[model samples]
Target: LVVLLVRLHLTGFFWGDCSLSNTLFRRSAGEFAAYLVDAETGELHGVLSYGQRAYDLDLLSTNVFGELLDLQAGELLDADVDPATLVARIGERYDDLWRALTDVEEFSVDEMWRIEQRIERLNRLGFDVDELDIVTDWDGATVRIQPKVVEAEHHARRLQGLTGLDVEESQARRLLNDLDAFAAAHGLQAEDPMIIAHRWVTDVYEPLRAMIPDPLRGIVEPAEMYHDILVHRWFLSERAGDEVDFFDAARSYVESILPARAATVSAAETSGPDELSAVSPSDDDPSFD
Candidate 1:
């Protein structure tokens, strides 16, 4: 909800009565994605003033607070959830997010590093700046810069460029992190990313999936399985007080964990790339099993 509101505000959208009750959520990759249900009261502007965003955030906070109260009354709220403190941070965090996305940043001519820093932060938040505008005063002592055209899929596109993996944005980010670790561990940092990516997919990812027993093949998406293995590796490493390699973690996860997990793919699925084809007996044998 916070991210949706923040992005909307960044694009000069004033969602006039946003609320928890107005959201529809779906399990996206590994996170819940929310959609705005009621847009009849919304307004779009070329640009929203500070007071406008602040007013919208205030309304959002109130709606969230009211919803939390209802949830608490019905015993649907978590024990650790505090409605008051959570609502209080809404405005402050939105302001910070708004600034990070659309705010114009100025730096002295010598401090060119700030430009890359700003871009890195935006990329980390899953934004791609298609156009950047830089202006310098007559004195030429400093530069004023702003991201003009921003879009999502910053990490997804990069991963696609290297590995041709079309995955959800969060999944791409997780996979890229693992790919970097794999490259560094294998002393392939100096090699081309495409070359290293091919090796990583063939040597690391495919092999991991191949290790899954036929019964558990439909438990989860292959990329999601690899993502969990990376997470599981971290947990196993922490408990053992040493870094656990992928092989050790994957072996333990398959034997001790994967079989116990409920399959995400429905049993109704009839055909998939991994399913075996029916074998027909040759003319030499009339019987076919």
Candidate 2:
């Protein structure tokens, strides 16, 4: 909720009636992402003043506090939930994120590497520093820098550009790491990035996606399933004292992990070992590593 509010404020949007009921949450990788659902009272401007942002935060606190209290009275609230603490923390989280995005930092002229460090920090936070404002003191002894224009989904955009996979930021980050490993493992690190990404998509990603049974498709998202399979592969590899084959790992995941989810698969159409083995790539497919 705080992240959604921060991004909306960044784009000069004022959500007048911010509340939990006005937002929707979805699983992004392992983390939850918030989206504004009812923007009926929202307004757009060239820029929002401090007072406008403050007003939105106030409304959030008020509406959420009342809602939580109502739930508590009805015995519907979680036992660990404290309406007061959660409401107070919302503003605190918002301020921390806003400052991290827009605050200016001053440093000695010799510490120019801080600029790259700052960009890396923002990227790690799933934001891109599109434009930065850097100023030097009159004496040239110190420099100040702030991000002027920032955007979110830094890793998602990069992953999409490379492989055309539109996924959540954290999932993209995980997939990109696997992509890098794919390139390195196959000795394609020196090849063109687009070409390498294409190879990874065809040999690594798409094959696993095709192996997912129709009945199991909706148990989790495709990208997240791929990530979980990678994690499962690591554990399987460790247990066997050797690297587990990717296809075998994926089959194991579909048969073992997916059934534990709420969805059930029909026995006749499930991707059993023989079905997956039939669709598995050839040994020479070049994604083995």
Candidate 3:
């Protein structure tokens, strides 16, 4: 909610009536990304002044507080939830994130590395610092820096460029890590980035994707399923005190984690590309049986 509001405010949009009821959420990787549902009370200006932003935030707090109180009165809210505390926390988080995204920083001339560090921090927060404003003191002993323009979806763009996968930001980050691991595992670190990405897609990503049986395909997204398999592999590897083969790990995932629909995938159906087929699921494997 705060992220959506901040982005709107950055773009000079004032949501006059902001509340839970006015927003819709969609899954972004494993996290929720907020979107405006009803903008009837919103106003777009050349640039919102400080007072405009403050009024919008205040209105949000007021609406949310009243709604929360109504929920509490109707016995719809959790007993432990404190409406006032939640409202205050929302404001606090908004302020903190707003500062991080827009506030200027002053540092000694010798600490120029802080500029790149700031951009890196923003990138990690899923934002791309598109423009920056930097000023130096008359004596040039100190510098002031602030981001002028910023946008989100940092990791998503990079992943899409590398592998043409249009996924949520967090999911893209997860998949990128896997892709890096794939490159390192195959000694392809020095290869052309595009070639490595294509190889990863063909040899690693697609092969694993093909193992997902048709019956279970609707249960989870491909990227999310892959992420879960990576997590499953980690746990299996930890339990076995060594790296588990990917196919074996995936077999365990299908049988133990997925629903009854997974039982239809036979050992032969789980067989993947040539690289993964070496450790193919056997007919007597518990998952297939």
Candidate 4:
């Protein structure tokens, strides 16, 4: 959690309202990565002061604690989980992440490898720095550096670049990794990414989309359904050590998975004004004969 918060700060973002719901967790190369959502209310500060950073941290902790309590009330939390201990640990995690992203060191001018090293750290944290904000003394004897405009959640963009499929941030990351694997298997190059993605959509995505039953079409968006199918395919592939054919996978998904998803949209059409009040009773009184 600390690692994620510090990363966001380093990227010049202040998650104005942070909480577990705004974040999604996914496994990447055996470690969990956090993706921040609900950034509509967030602020982008040119530079974050220590006090400002601490306040953001405090809000994170408070929000997380409150969320956990709410979960417990709903009987969603594990009985063994301790709220106080968990909240404290979250703070500790934030501090550690902060240090990794910002701790500076002095190096001789002869050693220029530090610059590369800094970029590598951010890359490992799933970020690509578009521009670095660096400061040098009047003599140019020493360098001070920070990332000026870092692009966060790169996986989402890459996935869309390849597949033209927009997805939720975390799911996009998962799908992008799969696309890379698919590219490698087909001996595809960076220049040929779109071609490969098209092949994937034709050979994989479309078949799954076609399998959606007409009655249950409103369960989720098609792109999201496609994303989930890819996830399901990955798990199945890992279990069996064989690639599952897209159509077969789609059949299984539509049968077993799609049915379980509750449709949020109602089938009944709403009555328009013309339909609701189409006819009115006459107010004329009948004369007695």
Top-lDDT structure, candidate number: 2
lDDT of 2 by residue, 1-289 (tens): 8888999999999999998889987656556678999988899998999999999999999999999999899876878999999999998998989999999999999999999999999999889999999999999999999999999999999999999999988789999999999999999999999999999999989998898788767666789778778877887888899999989999987876665432322332476644554544455422222
lDDT of 4 by residue, 1-289 (tens): 5567877787677887878889977433224567786888788988788887888899989999999999899876889998889999987887765665555655556666888888878666656778776667688778777765666556667777878876655666656666677778777766477798898777766766677777766555576666556666666677779998656666666665655442212221344434433332222311100
RMSD of 1: 10.7
Span of 10 residues, lowest total lDDT, candidate 4? 280-289
In terms of lDDT, model 2 sits at 0.85
Poorest stretch of ten by lDDT in candidate 3: 259-268
Which is superior by TM-score, 2 or 4? 2
Local distance difference test values of all predictions, in order: 0.78, 0.85, 0.82, 0.68
What value does the lDDT take at residue 200 in candidate 3? 90
Q: Which candidate model has the greater TM-score, 1 or 2?
A: 2
lDDT of 3: 0.82
* Candidate 4 pairs with clashing backbones: 2-93, 2-94
Residue lDDT tens for model 3, 1-289: 8888998998889999899899987555456678999999889997889999899899889998999999999876889999999999888988988899999999999999999999999998889999999999999999999999999889999999999998877788888888888899999999998999999999888887887778767555678667767777877898899999877888888766654323332332564344344444454433322
Kindly report which residue pairs in candidate 2 clash with one another: none
State residue 96's C-alpha deviation in candidate 1, in Å.
0.6
- For residues 1-289, could you state the per-residue lDDT of candidate 1 as single tens digits? 7778877876778998889888876444456556788898899998888888778888999999999999899876878999999998887887777678888999899998898898999999888888889998789999999998777768889989988887767788889988998899999999999999999999988889798888776555677667667777877888899998888899987775565342323322454423312222233321110
> How many residue pairs clash per model?
0, 0, 0, 2
**Cα lDDT, model 3, residue 16:** 90
Sort the predicted structures by lDDT, highest score first.
2, 3, 1, 4
Candidate topping TM-score:
2
Candidate 1: list runs displaced more than 4 Å: 12-14, 24-52, 210-219, 259-289
